[model samples]
Target chain A: MTDPVAQPETAIIVLGCPEVPVQQALALYVASGLRERGTDVLVTGNPSVLGLLKVSDPKSVYIGKTLVLETCIGEIVERKRDCTLCIVFAHNDAGIAYAATMCHLLPKSRVVVVVFGKDPEPLAAEINFPCETITEKAVHNPAQLKTKITRVLGWAVSRT
Target chain B: MGCIENLKYEKILPLGASFKECREYVEKNYPEVWYVEPGYKLFDEYIIGLPPIALGIENGEKITFPYTKPCHGTYLLRIEGKEEVERVRKTAKTKKQAGYR
Candidate 1:
């Protein structure tokens, strides 16, 4: 028998700056990690990320410009209200701030931040948990990234 | 590395231990951004990206780092909206992929 916990239908990725493609790349790993964990994901961002994902994974993404924090929250809340578990990735500083603000917007939703390092990719963490950083041990290997992503997503989803 | 911080408009003024002083501070205590502690001055134009981007200095070098150095100048930049940042990033990505460096 499979685990009764069905995968989340929506994954909200919120990066702080529209300029950071590196962050977008990191988010892609994260979204991919989530997808492997059986969750459907949707990435939203300014034209930068939206355009990139459009060319990359167009179906599972939503590209928009200037989505107010509240409206973004509403969209996710409604989706989850339909009983689909939802997870959020506030990717960077912008994503972090957005996550904090989002907590107020959707009291029922859960937020996570998987901080990516400049050189070696960092570890992932859920909101309100002890987040690990990459500096401790270089996550240079690709397998480590997948392992970390799956670990973080599982850790995050279990709480909610 | 990515300009992951939110592009918000606020009168955020960062101050520190003369860049050099900050290094000492970090070495002894912890990393502290001089931009906002006690009192730092942000320019009147307050823009998006960040105080660094607004000042037209996007991660090159600080007047002081690892030790105390006098701040020569500060700026209050007009924040560029989301569209503009994307334009630059898009260009940068294309150039980087094509071996612009």
Candidate 2:
């Protein structure tokens, strides 16, 4: 018999450090892909990031349930929410910190770190969590990130 | 009360050994702060073009961590009166202790 409480099959796309334009586009791109696969998609970020996405996808067509950055972290860490996949987008020092914090918060969830911009390997290494790392050189180009985002989501899907 | 509405804006990137230190400094210095979730500053800065997006402190000290263009990085915006600026600055510097860093 299956357990009465069902594990949350949530696919969280944690986005921060929107220094690069691709960061916003890539986030929406990934969310759309996840939704297509029938996965519960949750996009977590600050008001600034969420506002942009809201304007871009005003109808919430591609974007799913949006959570404030702290609330999302709190829910995941407190075990109030169960997640199967976690993806963090890191562009700078602070972005890495956010990613590391998420990794620490959701230990059981499969975490993936996507490092963009120049010289991402070192930044990715600082995550300090067991996560799959994907680095992209095209920080300004959203198209390139699209391909990579697809590959990453595909990977997340397979693992789940 | 009127002074709160006329506060000047100052942006800071808190330098602390840990995130907790940074948080504590903001809390002590600014009387009112609202923390926006970590990953959402971009929208408030770019799309909304507004203040008080996700502030650490609110009211007299309208502290918001909104993103700027080109990813200059997240900054703490202190919206306080002119007289309070120096006091806040002094507190911000003093909070970073030898061990905290």
Candidate 3:
């Protein structure tokens, strides 16, 4: 059987812990990128970001566990739900990607992980996981925001 | 990130790209003048050749792609939006297969 980890495909889950508007803005932009592509964009953030995203009765389902820690591995696996993308958000100088590099059980083809940062150095990439793909997008200013939109659409169009 | 209200480490750091790849991107883009120390090491690991071709870029700068097993992978490095990836094509590089098309 083909290794499931090698082919990742799922909803884009923006992973990050946001405390400031600046950080939330970047993550939101990236999430919007995927959503614009018609792909479901799921944001996995802390209470601050989650609050910002607005936890409605429907979207407010508390995870009660973190996928990274495998706290509910069996349950998450069973409820992996049809995800087409997964974007892990981060801030500048943040190590979001660093932490993700250690995960081994991610379903291949059902995920495209990203660690959003404050800056652009690590923006838009394919690295880390042996079989998985990840990208980093940072939009610090208006010019960068435009670039971010262009690059994101480029990615979506290319994927299509 | 410094002061002005120190954000929690978890809030600052989110696991995403591998450290190796992030470092590679930094070395390829940032101006050579900005390199401090380890930047030179990254250049040595990810850069294609001695005196990398992207004009105006300095030499022997810092690099952070530490030598590690399975570190051999194809990387597209560009500076000022221009690529210097061709300069570092070694005979060994030819043997590596492309991953994540």
Against the true structure, whose DockQ is highest? 2
Q: Which candidate is the best by lDDT?
A: 2
Kindly report which residue stretches of model 2 are placed more than 4 angstroms away from their true locations once superposed: A1-8, A155-160, B1-101
Off by over 4 Å in 3: A1-10, A20-22, A55-79, A92-103, A110-127, A131-139, A142-160, B1-101
lDDT of 2 by residue, B27-85 (tens): 55554444433323221222111211233434543444433321333445455443343
lDDT tens digits, residue span B1-101, model 1: 11212434332223321222232332333121222211111221111211112122122222111211111112222243444443333332121111111
- Give me the iRMSD of candidate 1, please: 13.3
Candidate number 1, chain A TM-score? 0.53
* DockQ of all models, two decimals each: 0.03, 0.09, 0.03
Every model's TM-score on chain B: 0.22, 0.33, 0.22
lDDT of 2 by residue, A1-160 (tens): 2222222367898887556788888898888877766779999887788888999998899997898766676566556876788888887756666666566667788888888877777666655556788887757787766776665555434534
What value does DockQ give for candidate 1?
Answer: 0.03
Model 3 lDDT per residue over A5-78, tens place: 22222343444454424445555555555455455444554354456555422353322112321222222334
